[model samples]
Target: MDAAEALTLLMSPQGRVDPYPTYERLREHGPVVQALPGLYVVTGYAEADELLRDPRLGVLDDALRDQVWPNWRESPAVSSIARSMLRTNPPDHSRMRRLAAGAFSPRRIAGMRDVVRAQAEELLDGMRDRAGDGAPVDVLADFAYPLPVGVICALLGVPATDRPLFRRWAGDLTGVLEPEITVEELAVADAGAAELRAYFAELVAARRRTPADDLTTALVQVHDTDGERLTGDELLANLVVLLVAGFETTTNLLGNGLVVLLRHPGAAAALRADPGLAPAYVEELLRYDSPVQLTTRTTTAPVRCGGLDLPAGSTALLLLGAANRDPRRFPDPQRFDPTRDQAHPLSFGAGPHYCLGAGLARLEAQLAFPLLLRRLPELALAGTPRHRTRLTLRGYQTLPVTLGTPAVADRGTPAGAHPGTP
Candidate 1:
């Protein structure tokens, strides 16, 4: 397929269903294909890997963002993302990244282990009740979505009752990240961003009066205690970004991982038998069906890559999903093998901008998969799963599953569940 034709398919609903074919078609044009006069797409593993860490290929900083969308500040969602480290570069990015990284310290994430287990158990209890009598339940909505939400909320010290508010707000706010968003989508994002800002502002105030051990409180302390380091706007925007980032991609990871496990019954069974294999299994899942697919970088200076020479100020669209499955990187790239060695996928991206929540996502999945397999002995795909019609983040919209209870003693008293759940 021609470059234009391949891009057209990639942007269409058909590509949303299976964009791998289109990625391959684009790859045929070479590692880097010029889509337009100044726009290029990189689909090769080596090229993408090299470019992701190249500082010369940078993101649209604040000045450029203002130029692209002059009235962006009018939309809370766009403005929030524009201000956060998500879009910043260089000296600014370095400081913001340092503070954010401190908040998600290794000790903090490790401490959440017990909390994650408890939350997973509670969610599983609810899932079991909903699937009583062998009734089918939508895993995507019932389990996958709520599990991450619960985990992230617990870390942020958000109360259980207020948890539901994030579901709608996160969806509305995150739509702006898509490659093609409609006018209506932007409006929803604006409203969501506004509400999030207000909510976090109040929460930040509450934390100031009485400090807590949560991530939000930690951020509030930093912002107020050291005004020169983090501004009020940066604090609010980071909070909003954290709440969304904490769970959005993870929801996809859990949903997609379950489907992969089910398809390979042996892998599922092996996991049920021995949960120790979770680390490797989770890595393969990230490689097999990545939660995120693509990202972009702009040229800061004239550079040559992937056998192409381009002028400065050009946009390079990095095809992460394609690079993950590139034959040069992984032998038999299409197959799902948990046993595969050194399977380093760009699913979470690379370089200084690597996903902040990647470690947490892996921890959640590693814990989740084992518990899921053991609890639902008769668990199986009960209906056809539908993929979300978005290419940036790939996952299911609804995953119907059956949870039948056999009289097997092994299914008794799963670790995460409370009393009388079995």
Candidate 2:
């Protein structure tokens, strides 16, 4: 397939199902290609790395959107998120990120290890109860989904009762980030964003009235020596973004990690036997099949990228999934090896906007995987796994498995199973 054709297919359903081959084709032409007028696609490892850290490139902020897609803010979901650090440029992004970073201190992250272990054990217990008598249970529905959700909610001080509601809102709201979205999807996303805005407004107000020992309360009080900090709107928008971002990526990681472990019995055995091996295993999973496939950036000025001197006003689609597997950067990319001393994956991205929850996401997976293997020896795929339709934010929609260790499961051969490598 040619570069343009491969790029087109990457956004198609078939491509979303498995884009690695398409990425190979796209990378063949070069690291970067002008997919269309005003749009460039970057698939090469070196080029993607250069562009991510390039100060000339930035997210599609409000001013940039107005100049390009003027009606972009017509959708409430779009407008609301655009106000947050995720979509804003330097000054605003730096200010908000500083406040949020304080809440995500190294000490705080280190302390979450115990919390993650507890949550993972609790979810596994629930999964075992549901899968009693050898009945099948969806890892996505029972374990993978709730584990990260519960962790993020606990950090944010969100009530347990309100935890279930986030799944629907996050699903609806996150779709707006995709390049392709129908009117129906956009409507749902708008409603979700509105609901989130209202909910956080009250929650933040509540925190002000009665402070708590949680991330939200920490953010509410965090400030610089000059007393500069997140404004009310920034606080609301960021809180909503944090909840959605925190869980979605980790959920995908857990679901994807589980399948790979099931497929590669050697790796699974190693991880199960040596708990210390989890850090490498989880990092390798991020490279092999990244939860976040792509991210976009627009040029603040004429910038040299992908062996081309593109003009200002150009937008580049950084194919991070492809870059992670680049042959030059990683030899034998397709084969998943936890022991391969390899470069870091662009899965959490790079530069100033690197994922804020990246540490926590990694922590969640590293703790959850070994427990999953040990706690449920019989856990094996019960049926063909299904992935979510959305391509931009990829993950399992459902992963059915039986708790009664299917015959020969230890050898990576289980009932109703497919190849473990995604």
Model 1 Cα lDDT, one tens digit per residue, 178-289: 7778899899989999999999899898989998988889888888899768889888898888888888899999988899899999988877777777888988898888
Q: What is the C-alpha RMSD of each candidate to the true structure, in Å?
A: 3.5, 5.3
Give one digit per residue, the lDDT tens place, for model 2 in 174-201: 9998877888989999999989989988
- lDDT at residue 55 of model 1 (Cα atoms): 83
Which run of 10 residues does model 1 get worst, by summed lDDT?
Answer: 406-415
How much is the lDDT of residue 261 in candidate 2? 91
- In order, the Cα lDDT scores of the candidates are 0.83, 0.83
lDDT of candidate 1 vs native? 0.83
- The estimated TM-scores of all candidates read 0.94, 0.92
